[model samples]
Target: MRILVSNDDGIFAEGILALIRAVADLGEIVVVAPDQQGSASSHGISLHRRLVPKPVDLQIQNVEAWSFSGTPVDCVKFGVTQFGEQHPFDLMLSGINEGRNLATDVLYSGTIAAAGEAALQGIPALAVSLDGPPFPFDEAAQVVRKMVDRLQFKTLDADTFLSVNIPAESVDGPWVVTRIGAEGYRDRFIRHTDDDGQAYYRYVGDVVRNIEDDDSDITVVNKGCISITPLRYRFTNEPAMDTLKTWF
Candidate 1:
């Protein structure tokens, strides 16, 4: 299988290298990733600026890599539109990310956004992340390898992709299919004055978990299980349509 790999954590991050090592035996691997960190960039694309993708002299066995001066979504877009024409990819994998992207965190994750972009282009995609302060990328990569192997034979919808979150403690737990959870960081900003008396604000927040919901991705990961949540690009709220139609 031909595979394309990309990440939001930049091209030199250990997470992306671990991902490459984990799936090296799968097929031909081509990587297009951001040149710098893009953690909370979401699905943002660099529309008004010149996107420069430069070839990187990476020594990973049997892999070609490039670094892009754009968002993670731009990497996938370039991969699909340019490199894909020469060698169509069977799958697109994004990140063994430094931190877990679960619940509402997916809304701000460039890692998940890369996979989502691939799904939009009709390619099978998966975004893998791990919970970490001390990122155990090697262990997470092993789990990702097994998951990728299993996914090789499975058929997924063209419009959907998988967002996987692995617990940092262990990879021995069962894999669970889950829904997006309500857990998110409560918004908080600290106002500060600069030396010149200029006011500035810094964003900060605590992760709030919805413990009552067991079927959510956050809960499953917290319980030491791998959480695989299938996601689609559609944002339409179908249930609210009828309520608005009554007014019309």
Candidate 2:
């Protein structure tokens, strides 16, 4: 299997590095990741600016790597359009992100977006993430390695991707295929101005879990189980179309 890896946490992030190391031996691995952090960037692409992907010889788990000065999605797009055409890839992998991506968080996750872009291009993709502070990446990598090994890459459907979130607690071994939980933080953002009269705002407060719903990611994580949600690009309102038509 040929695997292309990328991440929103930049090329040198511990999460990406760990993931690359873990999955390097699984197949022919190539990395095209942001030169700097691009978290919460969503599926944003650098449209106005010419993307400059520079190849860097970084020793990641003894594997050679490259870096990019664009969003995570850009990395995947660049890899497919440039390199994959010649060599081809069986799969595309993103992250082992520093934090969990659950519920609506997927809309703002560059890690997930990277995989989404690949799926859009008809590649089997996986976006892996972990909860809380950076943990033992080597250990995490081992877990991911097993999952990658068992994956049936050729059987994946078009425009389909998996959003896998690992719990902070060790899973003892592999993670279960679970659904996205409805529970998540009541996100809050605060606006403020600096003394120099510059307008700036900072996000404040800690995330609160709405784990009352058993099927939500928060509940799953709280139970020490991994969540794997199948995702796609379509955002239809078929159920609400008639209701919305009434309003019109």
Candidate 3:
């Protein structure tokens, strides 16, 4: 299967390189990633400034790659729609992100957004992330390789993909399918002004387990297990539909 690989962490990131190397034998890999760290950029796209993509010779692992001055979603959309038709891809892989994309964090994650965009385009995709900063990517890459080997691509429904999160250690074991948790970040944002009087707001928050009994991505990662959450484009509140209808 031809695979399109992209990331929020840019092409030079060790995590992306590791993922590329691990999945090299699977099929043709085409990488189009952000020119710089897009990190928690979410599904944002560059609208005002012109997106500049330049061919890069990052022969580190000899993966065909390009760098785009855009968001992670832009990378995937541009790569598949603009570049992939010349050499079509059967699937898309985003990240091996530096941090875990759990719970509401996925909403703010450019890594997950890349996969989300691919899914929107009817391509099966996966978003892989590591739990902590300064984590070893080789370990996570190995897990990806193993998962890929054991996976059956046909089992996935149309326009769906998996979100994988690995614990902050070298683990050789089975993965656990889990639900996205309800836990969330605390402390909120910190806004300030710079010396030049430019206003700035930083999202400075820590993960908080507020519920005494809550099943979420936050708790799953805390228990040191690989979390595999099957995700889709649909967002519905079946239980709350009646309540919402009453207001109408």
* The candidate that achieves the highest TM-score relative to the unseen native structure: 1
Off by over 4 Å in 2: 60-64, 184-197, 205-208, 244-248
- Each prediction's whole-model lDDT (CA): 0.91, 0.81, 0.83
Worst 10 residues of 1 by lDDT: 205-214
lDDT tens readout by residue for model 2, 1-248: 77889999999888888888787776678889999999999999888987787777767553547788889988998889877998788888898799889877898899999999999998889998887664666676677777777785346779889998887676443466666655445657887889998988787635665544666666676678777788888898798999999999
Clashing pairs in 3: 181-216, 181-217
| RMSD per model, one decimal | 1.3, 2.4, 2.3
Q: Model 1: per-residue lDDT, tens digit, 1-248? A: 88999999999999999999898888789999999999999999998999998999778777889999999999999988888987789999999899999888899999999999999998999999988766889888998889888988999988999999988886768999999998778889999999999999999978876664788897888898999999998999999999999989
lDDT of 3 by residue, 178-247 (tens): 7777767787788899999999998788878666233455666677778888888788878999999999
Please estimate how well model 2 matches the true structure, expressed as its whole-model Cα lDDT: 0.81
Candidate 2: worst 10 consecutive residues by lDDT?
171-180
Clash totals, every prediction: 0, 3, 2
TM-score of 3: 0.90
Superposition TM-score, candidate 2 onto the true structure: 0.89
